[model samples]
Target: MPRVLHTAQALVDVILEIDELPPRGGNANARSERWYAGGAVTTLIAAARTGAEAVHGGAHGTGPHGDLIREALARDGVILSDEIRPDVDTGYCTVLLEPSAERTFLTVYGAERQITAESLATLAPQPGDLVCISGYSLFEPTRDPLLEFLETLPEGVDVVLDPGDPFADFPRELQRRVLARTTVWTSNADEARALTDLDDLEDTPEAIRRRLAPGAAVVVRDGDRGCLVFHHGRGTQIPAFPQKAVDTNGAGDTHTGVMLAERALGADWESAATRANAAAGIAVTRHGTESAPTRAEVDEFLA
Candidate 1:
């Protein structure tokens, strides 16, 4: 089995359920809790749960939050060998969940922003490994390191780029560079629009895939509308299973992790996306990112 290497931000997420979002300076009654997972770590956990040998390449801190991150990853069977700064604290984010299951996030960069190119080079991923790069790590400090790492990837290695929300204004050069090396690119509808600058948000998956890397497989997720997958010059739109949505925090991460796991298990692109859509459909029906469904749940959902 190919090892899945994930290079991105890992943080401690503080989730809050609120009756209503505060209007600008206005305050509201918001119920909040904390979770010890974010971004790449969250995806790595999902991937490991699916029987993948997952390794996390990122930075954390020596603080309590950092310890929590390590414990959580260790429990999930994720190999963590990246550096952690003693002075800096682990990154954190605040998730505000509304009644409609819509969520808004305010994040703070901590030691995760300190992941350097030199540190990433130590991973030494060989050909056939799957490298997962999160878009949130494309900011100022981590951008150069990520670019350097991507450029040095060996041939035959499959690269999966999931640029999450922070990369809306990512530079064209970096975007092109990353996309050029990407074998699979996954993004939500808003992210697809931001990356492609498409006027019609509801364009076909084939059209969106064309706008992206010409030869790479693309998966554009349309929330409850389902996900459209384009690969091998073919397009398939998989409808999302209707379920009572609780929170959509890590649904995209679940989809990406499951797709990569399927690919590693020798499934074709279409079949992988089919399984991924099912996994994510089951994910959003629950609250919190870490509450993603198990492999049995996914299999049952597909059945």
Candidate 2:
């Protein structure tokens, strides 16, 4: 199996359910609450289920919440590195879920945010491997080290970058450096607009393609409507699989994970996107980050 290296952190998410978002100085009662293993693990699970070897290339956390992540990854059969941090406990995110299932997040950074060069070196990406990086790691504390890591990546590995909501307006120069090394760039519609300074960016995938690093593909995901992929000057709109969505948290992660795994195995763009679409469709119907479908589940959904 081909390898998709995820140099992302494992976060323990505390979920709180509320009726609606309240105004300033207002309070909302919780409908429910629980903890789950979230963050980049969703994408890795989706990719691993699709038959690629999933690797945790960064320092897996330690201590209380970190233990939960470790156990979940073990149960899911994800491969971990020796980069486990003993110096600090894991970080966590407080996710607020509304009645409509839309979410608002407040995070507390812990050990997961720290990425050392030595930890990254253990993965040793090579030709035919796929790398998973997010703009979250590029923002502040980890920016300099992460940049150093990206610059030193083995030439032939296909690098895939996803700029989560937090990275909507990432610095142009850093974005350019990442684009230069990225094989495929994935982002949400709002993120696309914010990053490109084009309010109507979705109208043309060409603009994204033109601004991308050489030989890279631009993938802009439009929730429910589907995702658009631009490569070699051609645009392909891969429609989302229709489903009654209950929660939207891990859906995009599932899609990116499945697509990256499929691409790593040499699958064509359309086919990869379609399968990823199905995986996300199944994910939304269920609850939580670990809800991403298995390979058999995705096949059955397609069938």
Candidate 3:
């Protein structure tokens, strides 16, 4: 089976549950608080749970936050690197979850951001591996190193680009460079619209497809409405399996991970996407960043 390799950061997520978000000048009290390994970890856990050999190639620090990340990855069977950043602790994102399951985030940079091409090369990614990249890594200090590392990837290695909410904020040159190397483009509906600069959401997928290299694929995830998948010059709509969402923080990551895992296991694009939709459906119905379902759970849901 093809492996799913991650080049994205895996940070500790601090989740605070609140009745609602505070206004710009106001303060809101959290009803509860918890911490978990998140960021790229969510996707990796999802893939690992879905029977893919998942590897986290990103950097982790030396403190409590890093310890939490390593423990979670190990618990989920995702392979983690032994190298650690001794000088600084791992960073975290403050996640505010509303009663409606909406989430907002504020992040702090740490050792994970201090990446280098030389360090990443240790992963030794080979042909037929699916390497996951996120728009968040396009920032300074890590950006150049990641781009440089991507340039050296061997043929047959698939680059999976998951442009986060800041897709439109990235420099045009950086965007073009990453997209040029990306073989699989997966993102949410708003991010897809931002990428294509289109007012019509219906046309965003095709526009994104045209922007990629020949034979590249695109998946635009629309909440509840399901996902739109474009491959080989054709588009298919995979419907969502509705579920009552309690926490949606990692739903998108769950979808991405399950989809890639299915692909790595020799499933067709449509079949993979359908399972992904089902996985995400199950993910949202639960709490925490590690809420992704296992292969058996996904199969049962689909059945």
Candidate 4:
């Protein structure tokens, strides 16, 4: 019986403008726009929607953005145990999209970077709880505290590490420290390559499982191609369901969150991975991170 806790950056994302981006340099014209809640908040939302008792622990500032984050989480049934710091501005990111649908992001970390060891300690995990730590929260000042908190967890609590792109930003030694204790690790192809230092990303999931924690499961997500799951000395690749992707922003988070929920509920690794892939496929067919589908939607997709 693993109670779930989610920790990471929580931010507002504004889709600045959609334009024709030249492969080389020059920009084009503004077309469409939208905004959404981002980071582990999105993942926590997904987890809660799937019937998991999820609590979000992260830093936000007292402002409109912070309100949006809190309101959005509440709407999804996630408990907010972490407080918003006084007067600080919540973080935001501006996304630039090209005609090819490729995206470039300009982010302001804002209050997310202000998370301290004390803040992490406040959300300490009890026995049989699972702590989901995000990669974006593991760089610089937050890194030490995040690691310290992970180390302090009571025995028997599971730790799931979703080292987003920030996995590359960490020093190898620091990354090793986190992975050593992680019961599960999730990332995409590029992230897998960077973290494992392997050029052949197709082999990364197996390599990472072998080298890091032989018993730990590894999930390597490949956009459009599908996702691969490595566990128990076996590998399974699940194909991505066909869908017209409107935005792929939170697909990975959705996949990871759903996978965790299914596993927590006693689903087998293959079944959980398949369910996760279907959930993420549904996520991409919609706009924004919070648009991730409900458990019913995933069941429908699976059916």
Candidate 5:
């Protein structure tokens, strides 16, 4: 089995660089246009770029957009799972970038939203594998499949959870189950606060730790403020690498991918989070969601 067995969506992204976001019922002009692959694949590719053996499997549309994402994944040489849905069209997102490089995404989840338990059962994760679970999946209507899949992970397979959306909206029981299975949990600063009702950033990790079993790590990432990693009952803050972020589109996904990759490779928490920070730092400096740094690029950046 690959070190990282990731089950998530990979969709094409349509990028429009605008001076500012348009007001509701208003229009805006674009400075430029670009198309690239994006979404959960961001995490898988970022991890694969680190030279870790990686595999991605999930339902995706078989449309032209899916073709774009498929070609992109092929170029990276990532192993793919045969769970594609040919009847539906792949999802795509329109990413609007402001002058400050912040992004606003208008997404329409497509074929990928049709994930089911039968498809997920195809994943044969072995001992020591890391199965990436995204909150995006939880938002889908097929909760039964997701619950079943999570409950069925092999004993040696550990879960790394990234509650991808609305931390507050996540069902309490789902959170409870995932936290129980999670070996490492990642969330943004705001999500962490919402989930734990903790204000002190330093205190959030501890609060999260209380929910997780011992030996699990909680990573609270505050964009530009850096990140905190809590493992074995101790927390360490790792400062973000300074960069002129051109687009903040997939920085968090890049961080997640790199971190998972490093952990699967036996790196300690500090080392993995540090490398993930560097990888995300490089990602935001470039354009497009597939902008994760390669192993050479990350090493060069660190050097």
Candidate 6:
């Protein structure tokens, strides 16, 4: 079976439940606070729960934060590549959750951003594997090494690119290089629009497809309205199972992870996307960054 390999950062998420965003000069009080393993960990955990063999190939620190990330990954059966950085601690993201279930973030980088060709060599991606990457990895220190490693992927390996909220801000040249190797492009509707520069939401998927490698697939996820899955000159809308969302931090990652897991498990794009939609629906109804549903839970929800 093809493994779901992640080449992205996993950070500790310090979540604060607050009433609303504070003014620039003001501060808001939090009703509660919690923490969880986030970032790439969300995707890997979702993939692992969906029965895919998940592996994390990013650098981690040799401190408390890294220990937390490692524990969460291990709990979910995700294999961690042996690339622990010495002395420094892993990074963290401070997430503010409002009553609306919307979230704002402030991140602090650490050892995870120090990826290199030597560290990435531990991943040793094999042909037929689905390697997942996030847009965050395109920043400075980490970008060059990751790009270099990507160029050496074995034939038949599938690169799954999840363009996060900041994807539009990445360098144009960097975007081109990554898209040239991306076999699967998964992101939200707004991101799809940004990538294709299309006003019509319906046209962005096809336009985005043109930007990727030939025979690439596109998945445009729209909250409540479901998602668009385009591949092989065909496009289909996979309906979403909407739920009352509480914390939507990891919803998109859950969708992408489940989609890749299903694909690795031999499901067609459409079927995999349908299951992914169900998983994301369940994820939003829960709390925290690791809210993705297990395979049995997803199956029950679909049934």
User: Per-prediction TM-score, please?
Assistant: 0.93, 0.95, 0.98, 0.92, 0.96, 0.98
Please report the TM-score between candidate 3 and the true structure: 0.98
The stretch of ten residues in a row with the least summed lDDT in candidate 6 is: 114-123
Q: Assess the local accuracy of residue 99 in candidate 3 as a C-alpha lDDT between 0 and 100.
A: 90
- Model 6: clashing residue pairs? none
lDDT of 5 by residue, 1-303 (tens): 348877777778999999987789999999999999887788888988998887877776878988888888888887777566867888889999998987888888788777777677677788788888777777656566777888878776878888765645777887888788888789899888888887898999889888875578899999887899998878999999989989888899999999988988888889999999999999998999899999899999999
The 10-residue segment with the lowest total lDDT in model 3: 76-85
Clashing pairs in 5: none
Query: Of the candidates shown, which would achieve the greatest lDDT relative to the real structure?
Result: 6
Q: Count the backbone clashes (under 3 Å) in each candidate.
A: 1, 0, 0, 0, 0, 0
lDDT per residue as tens, model 2, 1-303: 568888877798888989998998998999898888888888888888888888887666669888888887777788886567887888989999987879999988888877876677677888878888988888667777777888898777778888777665676787788778888788888878876677775554677667666777888888788888888888889998888888888889989989888887789888898898888889999888888888888889889
Cα-lDDT of candidate 3: 0.91
Clashes of 3: 0
Task: Name the regions of candidate 3 deviating beyond 4 angstroms.
Answer: none
lDDT of 6 by residue, 164-186 (tens): 87888787888899999999999
Candidate ranking (TM-score, best to worst): 6, 3, 5, 2, 1, 4
* Residue 125 miss distance in model 2 (angstroms): 0.3
Clash pairs detected, candidate 1: 135-163
Preferred candidate (TM-score higher): 5 or 6: 6
Each candidate's lDDT (Cα)?
A: 0.79, 0.82, 0.91, 0.80, 0.84, 0.92
What are the RMSD figures for all models against the true structure? 1.9, 1.5, 1.0, 2.1, 1.4, 0.9
lDDT of 3 by residue, 9-86 (tens): 988999999999989999999999999899999999999999999998899999999999999999988987538889
Clash pairs detected, candidate 3: none
